[model samples]
Target: MQRRDILKLGLGMAAVAWAGGAGRTWAAASGGSVAAGADTLDAAAWNAARQWTRTAFGRIAHVERGGGPAALFLHGFPLNGFQWRGALERLSAHRRCIAPDMLGLGYTEVAEGQGVTPADQVRMLADLLDRLGVENVDLVANDSGGAVAQLFAVAHPARVRSLLLTNCDAEIDCPPPALKPVIDLAREGRFVSEWLAPWQADHALARSPQGLGGMTFTHPHNPSDEAIDMYLRPLVDNAARTHAYAIGLDSNVLAGVEAALKQGRYPTRILWGTGDDIFSKASPDYLAGVFGDSRGVRRIDGAKLFWPEEFPDLVAEEARRLWGV
Candidate 1:
């Protein structure tokens, strides 16, 4: 069949599957989503060392220090908790920062039967928080993590003290068109994982100077080899790829969060990287419409999608101002 026809059939099957409640089970059972490993922290010496915790849900890795209230960082797709390396270091000065590699990303152990869907990941996060003895937190989320953060905040509003979002798709109508094929292939458990593995590697490499001009949105110094390796570890591993794909396919959390927001209000803020090639800055307008009209909106322009890395100080300052840390 033509690729477009296959996609059409996939969409139909997905709709029926969702209606039949099969999608939920599929998410729950796609276990061992994140792989297990040692801390992937950069070699920078620190005032206090970062720590790792193995949770009932998966790996609960984070950097902690002198504390105010807790600030939890959630990384985006195809990236791990390490994505927040710069921000975590800065935030640790004022708040206890916990950054976890979502179920299928980073060095976290992939759970059995757990698909990478946002709902499943959010539940896993709740479980992880419980294990960590955290009651409530300020959440900073970027890219795909934004949707996960939204679901968490809506389902357990009291658990979220405040929210800070970067370039991420929060509405069903606004998801990047490029993601559809990836979602369909993931649902089918086909060679889609293999097909995308190289791309994942390419993206990681692109972060480097040599790779940056070729693949990234802007040119800067080449990213260290360690940085590239750390990013690619999860993608090259088959188990991690499976979980990542599953998560991508099951990302209905955006729709769910939007529906919930219509019922009530939450304190939210938006920061976007204008250079983001994946999800653009315009994506946050959905949140702006939902939360801005009443509570007011705050934006930090020119921060890339990986704002935590590109503009760590700005993220730290905005988060502190928002959280009153």
Candidate 2:
């Protein structure tokens, strides 16, 4: 079957199953207290949604809100800020949450014929923050965002109040064995699509039959069709895939992070998902060792790289505790 057809079928099945019996169970599993999609701050909730112009970096589509201290959410590569829907719902209640579609991802337009680099992406983020009138912020980042956040913190220490990382790759002397091959492939500018295709296909297949085993904290009783649709939407196009490859090939994110830690400017905290297959638990340990006595590392049980989706409440609770929001 074609990719789109397969996604449609998966989404249809997911919707029907979710609408029937699994809806209540899914909600309960996520944390009975909070409502699904209740806390998300979208274009509808914000006063205005605008595209931020950063001369060297290009335009970044972002949303802004007024209130408490600024909290900027930097999303992982391949996925857009939509991944933060669950976390945003809880966070938006107190602080103003700024979730932007990074360069070459989501609604943000990428520069034609130019591959997005880690340095350029970080610069765009800096520009986005400045354009929004945010002086300093509590940084929340995941996956590739961790590297960008680290660089931002190092470059602009005064602009960051605290750091919260989830399933991210931080600068450590000894990196995980699992990532070595992928990192090497990325560095070589090889066929990252072919390298990542198997895992991506497996993830798609896992949504059915065998189920979300080992992928999510709890078995998804009723995974939202819309959620699945949103997740798969980006992959349907070449622009998204090309950017994903660009991010994979960029080695500076890792190297830049290492350089930043050596600078010793900002305080950092790491929240890792033990079940994350992308970046192994060893990555966090390596980060802890690099930070030495100053930094903190905490592990989340029954969660994977995509912890926000698998255990939204747990992520929110942990962020709240760490950031004191």
Candidate 3:
């Protein structure tokens, strides 16, 4: 048989299988239909962190599970708490895992006329921390969230117990070349309407390397459809939220953040995805220099932008050692 014939047969079988029994299992394992978001997570193995609280900012949404020292997870731009689902599940057994959908992302509702700048986010974080009844926390940060975490830790070192950093923006090259496309769109006021709207309309586009899924995880091709909707819709589909997030991204606001990391006092742990095309391999060391700590740098051999999603077990292991969980 020709190779094309064989490929056609395989596609036929896959479609047939998906139309029947195995598809159901895939859907269940992947958190149900594309709309379930984080709801369909298996409760037995997944701690299922869903809790909403009224904060001074608005009704903020967060994932909270387990009970011990507070371990707060911050997600990057264009994504939210959903990315930390696996880490939350793995570490919840020993520590309280709290992952929030920052200001305009996911289920975190941003109030009208609110700005989501890094400083604004830090203020929101403080308000949320106050409501969570915790004064200090072990913080884990990735991507744009890493910048936020750095600024927050530097400004309020008293609030952070330890910080675990993944691939993200450093002082030298903030967005990196590979990540500038989205930032560029935001600068022109065409992010939500042009970039995000089309991606949401086309599933394949959303999963392509040009979109969020491919930008996040590797090997698996793309994130489950549910994840995109949960993370993107809140910001990309809503004009207000999109505008809010874009405004924060449009400026050069990292001067204080750079100073903070260089001069701030905080315990730090470093995890970098060596295979990431966005943040270069030098990122981890650059971050270590910023934090003045080199003991905790560990590389995830082939993981990409969202390394935790690809290797949550490694993240959990490091968190266990770093936070003594």
Candidate 4:
């Protein structure tokens, strides 16, 4: 079947289930009681499981699961650690999974005057790991988080065991042209009130073609109502978060990191969604060429920018391959 057709079928099934009052919670085959949509975690559980750590950056919010070697998951722009809920559930058995909300985004309490650039995010992750007593970690990242992952690997090459990067900012397209309008809105400090506020008020609108679902998700109703609330509430609740997204995208933070990336020997794997329009198609190829220990790029047919949240199985599979687990 065509990808669009498959998506339609899934949406139809979900609608029918909702109409029939189907339960929202289910036991994942991998283990644990996951929320609807296969591997999702409900809002209440996600909120309750969060752990706060005090760092020089701020009071960082993160979720931890599993045991053994450490694996860190970085979420995309405007998203929190919740983006990796599915991957954490699946890969926790193999490695300790830790997903932290980036400063200025999610529920992380960022102190005033602190920067929210990719470089700053890299430093925040370093401090987070140090406080947690984790030395080296396998990195899994998507969207803008991918940019931070690159900076982290270069800044602390010894601390990265391997890298699994999905569609996001690369060296050439740090702030892709498609993001210019959003960046402009951020510059004006109107992104939260003008864009996210509507979505927070109307769940269906957020899932519509005009919002995040249409822009980044394969499924029209994806991110779910619960996820939409979880991801957007914090940003809209605070006025300070209005410009953070733009600051992070203001410049190409990955400009000079390519040379260092080529010199590093950390095993790397690139995953690109063919349907993503925000980033260049050549990016995955460019990244694969730059990494010294690249395992090549895997293209997900018809997937969009946020495919990591939709297809965590693929993320886990590639992570395991890169980690040689």
Candidate 5:
């Protein structure tokens, strides 16, 4: 089948599945349809709703929905706020959902000579919340964003109401072996042009056996054409964005974070995808061990690194449970 046909079938099947299954689960819990809101926010709608906040780091681009205690969603490497669109769509009804494009990725503009390490991302988030008047937030993150979430939780325990982590960099396996090739490319400042540009240019390549779909997503044509453009265009468009992108993956920024995380008694839960190749399978158990108040770990069988996007229903269900909403 052609890629466009696959996307059409996927969309139709997804709508049916959500309406029949997850919608019922959500209705049982909250007395409402999970598909109630403006379903999926495509590139145009997402861009229309985009807002910016100026900070010391740079102009931070973010999108928000709903109205209540804040819930912050973080994306993985080479992706942006768009990664959490599915989650934000479902959970926005329960909490004020915010998804920000981290510095060096997406639309977040970095200041001249600024760093985009995990540590730096943590500080940027704090500043962002402060500017937005969000005193605290329920944190949800996947992939590299998970590393930033961990650091943020430890650094500002009082500012984090709860934590939900997906497959990401852990202290025990900081900068896991799987990232070596990507890291090498980043180190040489060729990652964006050499890797992401092609995926952005060709959606089929992105969903092929050798691309993001084969590696991270469970479904072929998972990210869609609009998603591919929105997620990768910025990284490949400018020299500054590319430089910041490479800087973020240059080193093990998660070093020394474990000792700090273990001391915190914050409410935490781990959701790990067993099929992920980028992170260690033992990471969830390792993270559960480190957190003083770990609720538990939920292993998602056959799911890959980007399962949160693929399985937003599960993400929202677990997030609601963790937030006690």
Candidate 6:
């Protein structure tokens, strides 16, 4: 019998640069190199999304745009930075929008045993910023990215100017109770091959409610073929990359996060969706109470897990309002 049958386990789930720097001209600063993308600050393009070698995790990839205040974007679990595409474009006019594929996800390369724990993720960002010569930034994070973003804010408050946390794992409800089954499979070390292979085989089925992870998003009745390929291409066929996805599932990131937020020195804004089934409303409520002083909390009615995908413009507007930019 094949290994697939041996274990009747359940299925599982889951830049750049710019000219017009120094607020005047593009000047490569210390830390990392910044490539010039365009001639004007308002017209900078982020579509190229570049990659660089990071001392911490081999090659790291990220998308960037514009100039002025820096806004760092973080993506979440089982998904790459692509989720922030629409939002990045929307915010590109005023902010230096940036989104990096976290640790082993997206097109970033990873060694077999590289650690992607929330702690490691924090260090990775700090190093990346140091390379890019970014002094501070507004953090816009969703899903699992929020978890790392929280830790990051606590560890390096000076680097983060503001925080915008969308639906994500908060407090102790991480992986959210709904996703515990999937998390369990990841922890068991069988999720990648057993669960994903079957799902990737049928792209349409993978996007259906009865499909692999179809239950995660509330809008976009069906995930576009492009979306599936963009998000899952690396993991579906590669066992090493698949294992990389499961690398630090047991870390309790929220243990220190709440205290950090209560004692936080930077402004924070919460944007939540009331329709999410994987992450609870309570998580956002707790975050709102803590980060409320910044801009209070704004909830999206009838939106689900991937509200950014459904309403990127709305998120961009709220971000603008929250930051007064």
Judged by TM-score, which candidate is best? 4
Error of 6 at 117 (Å): 0.9
Q: What C-alpha lDDT does candidate 6 achieve relative to the native structure?
A: 0.66
Give the poorly placed runs of model 3, Cα more than 4 Å off.
1-49, 256-265
Write one digit per residue (lDDT tens) for candidate 5, span 112-131. Answer: 88888788899999999999
Worst 10 residues of 6 by lDDT: 9-18
Candidate 2, residue 241: Cα displacement in angstroms equals 6.0
Q: What is the TM-score ranking, best to worst?
A: 4, 5, 6, 3, 1, 2
Estimate the overall C-alpha local distance difference test score of candidate 2. 0.56
What's the true lDDT of residue 250 in model 1? Answer: 47
Score each candidate by Cα lDDT: 0.57, 0.56, 0.67, 0.78, 0.76, 0.66
Tens digit of per-residue lDDT, candidate 3, span 1-325: 2323222111000000012232233345545432233323332222233678888888888877678888899988677776776677678778888999888777877777777887789999999999989889889998878888887887788898888988877776565655455555566777677667766677677666555555346554455555556656666657667666756764545664655666655668889877676666777887787774434588878767776665666888898888764
TM-score of 6: 0.81
- Could you give the candidate ranking by lDDT, starting with the highest? 4, 5, 3, 6, 1, 2
Candidate 1 local lDDT, 1-325, one digit each (tens): 2444332221100000011122122223332111123222332322124456776665555545446677889877556666675666567667778888777666666656656677777888888788778898888997678878877877887788788887777675345554565556565664334443443466543443223222222234334444555555555676545546454644444665655665544567777666555564456676766752223445555434454555566777888888766
Q: Candidate 4, residues 225-251: lDDT per residue as tens digits?
A: 778778888888975664775666778
Model 2: colliding residue pairs: 39-89
Clashing pairs in 5: none
Candidate 2 residue spans exceeding 4 A from truth: 1-56, 64-66, 173-223, 240-252, 256-259, 262-265, 292-295
For candidate 5, the lDDT comes to 0.76
Better of 3 and 4 by lDDT: 4
Error of 4 at 96 (Å): 0.8
